[model samples]
Target: MIHRPRRLRTTPAMRALVREGALTPANLIYPMFVREGISEPTPISAMPGQYQHTLESLADAAREAVEAGVGGLMLFGIPAHTDPTGSQATSPDGILNRGLRVLREAVGDRAVIIADLCLDEFTSHGHCGVLDSEGRVDNDATLPIYAEMAVQQAKAGAHMLGLSGMMDGQVAACRAALDAAGHTDVAILSYAAKYASGFYGPFREAVDSQLKGDRRAYQMDPANRAEAMIEVELDLAEGADVVMVKPASHYLDVVADVSAQIAAPVAAYQVSGEYSMLEAAAANGWIQRERLIAESLTSIHRAGARMIATYWAVEAARMLRNSL
Candidate 1:
């Protein structure tokens, strides 16, 4: 009774002073979708308040996020064309690289610009890699494609590449490619523990994914935890500057474990499904929108994510700044 735990909770000032985790604009990375032919920002129905932007509109969005004090912007492109080899992905004129160029012009070193380094959005088969004659994702073949992609994105002015393909040896391949191309300054943010989760449903729509089958062949299984550490270690050894775990809420344990074991900065993605669920519930009057948004992000931060990729980054950044 003498050591009353409620003493710190007695006042807002006291609570702030003893707060263990702080969620701020500096911790957020906004994930943006850029469509090839769109003239305006097209609203994503599933992810309320989010949009797939045109190059012009995406530049404005990047400006807004930077102005709002968000730490970074992550770009995902929806190309105008798709092919068997995802040839457009390595093209300099491809949607993603174009978007990155636009953002670089708009922000001009104001914030970190990250390109999602994956082929799912550009491939006719909607897989993360090139297919073999037998019709399966060719892991070894995918590494070279990713290496080329890293160089292309770096040339496009991306500050970092979000390597989300889950291909083995991708980090080493990309690192080598980048260094050889004289893009050693561009960082690699490896999706070290990305799991094959249902939480990516809305994201497929966001990127216009043509996936005909599951990515379980490449993405990690959701049931495993220890494997996450191994993935982190491998990516780090292969030259990953940052490591990430996807679907932050569901795999906080993995996030914490990775953060604890690694010297590199750890990131967690609050994927599209997580945003949609809360938005849907809020629209139905089931939850407080602002509070849930803050809570969800704070929980991810508290769970040891040094940076978070979220759909709500700009709004959350504004809110955090206002609170301060």
Candidate 2:
């Protein structure tokens, strides 16, 4: 034959040399759920291998993740108390704040700590924002709450505040709060183009979310692409050091488009539902777990995600390091 495309795939060394995309432990950010009041961890039934940890165990988890070479850890709090205004979000004694302190102490700068700055976990209505008299989300009224939440996270020793609430002008509001509090060194990683999708179903279980309704009122619709670019621009203009797209596998186009349009670091979240799918397939022997995990992460990375928030961070990191 005149053309031999198989020549390049003939040897392992050749394949390795010609590989276009790569995944490493350094590119991963592990998401952890921390619950208040307990010495034992509770497993989330829908999401296998995921657990809600107490402060003590959570510190150990952070240490283990860092020891495994995971680059960062993302903290999500499952607060024990809830209120209309989510008053616990601004309290130093709140679960999220306490978890942040514990993780910061355990990791000791060995890994980057990014705290999920949202009120949903602490709010009685399980909405990301404060409700109006009509019981709908009030965007403007929520801004100050997020501002307070951001500052609290920063004060709790989080290196990066992950603004995942999807509220308009949230990034700017949090930035103002941080700067005003003299936390200029703390970075903001905004969830710029988060979509309202079914992929978040398992996550709701992971965090014990008491959501009464869908997040469509605030989160972006999956039908829109150009809107993602606008969200990215707004976040960047509002001083977001990083911007992210959620549910990375189904949204590579959004990730690539945002990466091309913005100068800041682009991140993608391979959320709980994504992990559970692969885990289920692997359990059924329909797919190879390790290989699929590596491939999925590599695809996100190749699509221009500078960082990936993944449930398989430690596992994928081990594979990548061992493969190297």
Candidate 3:
């Protein structure tokens, strides 16, 4: 009776003072979808509030996010055409590259702009990398293309390159390319432990992905947590400045484990499907929307994620600011 642990929970002020983890706007990165040659912001039906933004609209979006005090932004492109080799990924006029240019000019260093460096959006088949004649993801063949894409993103003024391809040696390939191009300052944020989970369903719609089959060929299986560590180690050795785990809520343990194992900064991506679920539930009066969003993000942060990429970045940040 003399030892009471409930003293800390006695009041809201006391709880705030004793809080160990927090979700701030500065820890949030807004993930945006940008398409080539657009006159209007195309609404993504699957992701209710998200859109495939035109270059001009994307600039306005970036400015709005900056005004809202979001820490960073990540860009995913939707190309008008796709080829076998995903050649558009390395072109300066590519949707992603142009979007990066627009964001850079609009934000003007007010926010960190990271480009999603992968071929899925540009490839005809919608795989993260190139495929062999048999349609298998050719890991080695994809590395060079990824490297080229990294340099192109840097050239377009991306503050960071997000290597989400999940291909072997992608980080090393990209690092070498950036160094060769004298873009030593451009950081590489590797999706080191991305799993082949069911949570990516809505994302395909958001990007208008032409994916024919699952991404299990390269993305990790959800059954193996230890394998994620191996991938993280490889990315770190290969020059990844930051390492990330995708589908954050379902893999908090993996994120925590990876954070413990790696020296690089750890990030968690709250994938589109995860966001949609929360939004749907909240719309149905199943859960308090703001509270649930903040709790989910707080859980990710508590799991040791130094940064979080989320569709609700701006909203979460606004809520956190008001709560403070």
Candidate 4:
């Protein structure tokens, strides 16, 4: 009886004081999609309230996110052109690189501007890497492109590269490329434990994916948790500044595991499908929108994510500020 745990729960202020982890706007990183050919901001039907922005709108959004106290911004580009090798990914003027440039110029060190260093959106085949003659994703062939893409992204003013390709040796190759190009300061956030989950459906729509099959060959299997540690350790050793686990809501265990063992910070991605589900549920009045949004992000943080990349970054930050 002397323990009296209920004492802390008696008042909202008391519970706030005893909170184990704090979820703030600074911990949220907004993931934005920018389309090369878009003339204006286009709403993504699959992921409501999110847009495939044009360069001008992207710049405006970057300013808005920075003003909202969002800690970082991650850009994914939908190129106007795609080839077998995903040539746009490494091109300086490609959509993602251009978006990075716009973000850096607009935000100006006010927030970290990150580019998605994967070729899926730029590949005609919708795979993360280039394919061999047999059409399977050739891992070795992809590393060099990733390296080249890293340098280009760095040159385009990306503060960080989100290496989400799940390719072997991607981090090492990119690190070497960036260093050689005098971009040693560009950090790499590797998607070390990205799972091939069913939750990526809405993302395919957001990017207008050309994928027919899945990326199971490279992405980690959702059934395996211990395998994540192996990937996490390898990416860290290969020069990943931060390690991430994707689909944050479903993989809180992996997030906790990585955060617990790794000496470095951990990032978790609250991907499009996860965002869609909550939005749909909230719209249907099945769940309380604002409270659930805050709770979902808080749960991810409580599970040990040092940072969370989410679609609701700006809105969530504003809600948090208003609550205070």
TM-score of 2: 0.97
Give the clash count for model 2: 0
Q: Give the per-residue lDDT digits (tens) of candidate 4, residues 1-324.
A: 779889989988899899888889999999999998879999999899999999999999989999999999999999888999999898887888888888988998989888899999989999999999999999999999999999999999999999999999999999999999999899999999999999999999889899958999889889999999999999999999999999899999999999999889999999988999999999899999988999999999999998999999999999978766
Q: Using lDDT, rank the candidates from best to worst.
A: 1, 4, 3, 2
Q: What TM-score does structure 3 among the candidates reach?
A: 0.98
lDDT by residue for model 3 (1-324), tens: 998989999998999999997668989999998888778999998888999999989999888888888999999999899988899999999888988999999997899999999999898898888888998999999998998899899999999999998999999999999999999999999999999999999998888788889998789999989999999999999999999999899999999999887767899999999999999998899999888888899999999999999999988888888888
lDDT, candidate 3, equals 0.92
Segments of candidate 2 deviating more than 4 angstroms = 1-5
Tens-digit lDDT string for candidate 1 (1-324): 789999989988899999998888989999999999877899988888889999888988899899999999999999999998899999999989998999999998989999999999999999999999999999998888999999999999999999999999999999999999999899999999999999999988888889988999889999999999999999999999999999899999999999888778999999989999999999999999999999999999998999999999999999999988
In angstroms, what RMSD does candidate 4 have relative to the true structure?
0.8
Q: Quick one: RMSD of model 1?
A: 0.7
**Model 4: clashing residue pairs?**
none
Model 3 stretches with alpha carbons more than 4 Å out: none
- Scored against the true structure, residue 177 in model 2 reaches a CA lDDT of 94
> Candidate 1: deviation at residue 167, Å?
0.2
The TM-score ranking, best first, is 1, 4, 3, 2
State which candidate, 2 or 3, has the greater lDDT. Answer: 3
CA displacement after TM-score superposition, residue 161 of candidate 1 (Å): 0.4
Candidate 3: worst 10 consecutive residues by lDDT?
Answer: 256-265
